[model samples]
Target chain A: MARIVTFFIMLVFWVLISGMFDAFHLGVGVICCLLVAIFSHDLLFYGHPDLLWVRDIFKVLAYFPWLFYQIVLSSLEITYIVLHPRMLEIIDPRLVRFRTRLRNTMARVTLAQSITLTPGTITVNMSGNEFTVYALTQKAAEGLPGEMETRIARALERE
Target chain B: MRELQEEAKLRMPWQDVILQTSVRVLIPFIQLFGLYVVVHGHYSPGGGFQGGVILGAAIILMALVFGLPASKHYISENVNKTLSITGPLVYCGIGALCILFGGYFLDYSALNRILPLGPIAWRSFGIFLVEVGVGIGVMSIMLRIYRVLSSAGTIDQGL
Candidate 1:
């Protein structure tokens, strides 16, 4: 079933990309997609029975806009810091480490990426539940793994 | 023996739960975009090589985040070897097909004899087919090289 889903997805993607409607083009696309599907279907679909795939998809859709807004907010903060006359005095660059409660790998990665994507904080390193982040300001580093971690955990929670 | 295992675990880089979670979510979209690039090469700035690299990068990202053994589970060495050859074969095969149809090598218009599509349409379709082949070949080769180099020619341990 997963294999079939992978195949159809690849086919639809191929057709969408290749606007040619001729029989020859469609036939070639089908052949190419079939070959790819047969070889790499497992790569695309791991098929964990416990996964709430549909619900998670919707959750992610809701999460991205929030992440984007956070990104904009951080960027503005960073921009202000950079443009300030007393930039050196205002900035207190430091590394902060903290552990997170999120267990899922996907959720963990999202948090790290979001941290890095946000301007004021960069995830310097991550190990297990512990993350070492570099923050441009003391304020940015104050609440380490606070809201971002909670939001990512909520976004990825199965329930 | 247990002491050595513990030491190894300590030496191994720590896994961040957030990174793992986000990469899991992002991989599918990255691969889908890669396929889009390959199929839409005719109309877009991207082509087989660029799309193939992007696809390869997705796998590399997986390996970096999840570890080598986990990624090998998805694309084994033998399958990788076969695909590396298959891509170029597909490309050459189309050219050979053109020859079989009594046209010069890589003459896509010759495909009209087999499909009865107009010469112009055949040419366009043929280019798409070749692009698919190139994309496949490049993607596989990139994965193979990364596997080899990162593992230091031994698939057992990867950096």
Candidate 2:
């Protein structure tokens, strides 16, 4: 079942990238996709992705817009900080550590990546559920693993 | 013996749960992109070599984040060896095949005699096949280099 889904996913991706409708091209794409599916079908869903994954995926899709908004907001804030005459004072860099309730590995990593993606903060180290983040200012530092953690939890948490 | 095992566990390769999970989630897409580059080489800026390196880097990224044992477990010695060997064979085999068809070495259009795709199509396709071969070869070799260097010619845990 997972293999079939993987095959279709690879096929769709192949068609999208190949951009060819010819029978021969389609045939080759099928062959290549089949090989990939056979080799890594188990990997596509990561350890028996159950029916709940559909819900999780849709949840993640919905989370993207909010994440994008955060990215834009952070970028604008970073720009303001850089352009300010008192940039050094504004850039009060500090490392902050916090524990997270998110238990799922995928969820935790998503939070970490999202945090890093947003400007002004970098997820420097993560041990177990604890994230060691570096932020350029106290304002940025205050938001460490805050709403992004909750949104990702909503998106990826299994239970 | 028990003490040695305990010591090994104490110094077990640093496993950041975030890095491991992130690498796992990222790997399939990277491999897919690598395949895309290999197949698209004819019309694009990249060909087999670049595609192969990208493919190889996915595994290298795996090794970097997940450690040697996990990497080795995912891609065993036997599988790696076979992939490395098959690449060159695919490359030279096509060249030899062109020769058998009474064409000069690496002359792709000569492959038209085997399956009558038009010469123009064969010429384009032959390059794709060679690129695939190169991609496979380069990827495997790149992985081998990393594995050997990291382990210092030993597959066991080492400094």
Candidate 3:
């Protein structure tokens, strides 16, 4: 079942990109896609068998808009800090440590990437549940692993 | 068993919930974009090699973040070895097919007899096929090199 789905997805992707529509092109696409699907289906869908796949897909889709908004907000904040006259004084760079409730590897990674993607904070290192983050300002570092962690946890929660 | 235990003990310093979650979310998109690059080479700046490298990097990123053992579960050493050969073989096979069809090496227009797509269309379609082959080959080779290098020529231990 997964193999068939993968083949169709690959075929659609191939047709969409190729745009030739000639019988020959379509034939090649089908053949190539089938070959790939047969060999690589497991790689495509490896791990995370517990979650409802459809629901998780939608959950991730819903999370993107919120993440983009957060990115914009942080970019603006970083720009303001960079342009400030007392930039050195305001930029109290510090490292913060925190642990999250999220247990799934995927969820944990998403939260870490979210932190790094947001302008003010960078995830310096991570081990098990704990994260060491570098923040550009004292204020940015203040609420370590707060809203973003919770939001990602919610987005990827198994239940 | 003792060596395996020692390897396990040489752990990365930190792991956070956020990093794990984000990588899971991002890897699929990264691979999809890589495929897009490979397929849209005619219309885009990217081509087979670039797209293949991107795909390989996605897997490498997974290995780096999640550890080598976890990645092997997705793409085992045996499968990787086979794929490394299969990609180039696909590319060369197409070329050889063109030759058997009575055209010069890599001459895609010769494929018209087999598919009736006109000489010009066949040529374009031929390029697409070659690109796909190249993409696969490059992706596997890159992954193979990274795997060997990180593990110090062994499939286990090291990174």
Which candidate achieves the best TM-score against the true structure?
2
TM-score of chain B of each: 0.92, 0.89, 0.90
Between prediction 1 and prediction 2, the one with superior DockQ is: 2
lDDT of 2 at B89: 97
Per-residue lDDT over A21-134 for candidate 1, one digit per residue giving the tens place of the 0 to 100 score: 877557767766776667566556546423366677688898899889988988898889889998899999887888888887667777888889888889876667777788
Candidate 2 lDDT tens digits, B1-159: 354346446755366666667666667667877887887787777989999999999888878887777778878888999999999999999999999999999998889999997999999888888888999999999999988888899976523
Candidate maximizing lDDT: 2
Which parts of model 2 are misplaced by more than 4 Å? B1-14, B108-121, B157-159
lDDT of 1 by residue, B85-158 (tens): 99999999999999999999999998899989799989888988899899989999999899989988998756
Off by over 4 Å in 1: A1-53, A64-66, A103-105, A125-131, A149-154, B1-11, B14-18, B69-71, B151-156
Q: What C-alpha lDDT does candidate 2 achieve relative to the native structure?
A: 0.82
Which candidate number has the best DockQ? 2
Error of 2 at B15 (Å): 1.7
Higher-TM-score candidate among 1 and 2? Answer: 2
lDDT of 3 at A26: 67
DockQ of each candidate, alpha-carbon based: 0.29, 0.42, 0.24
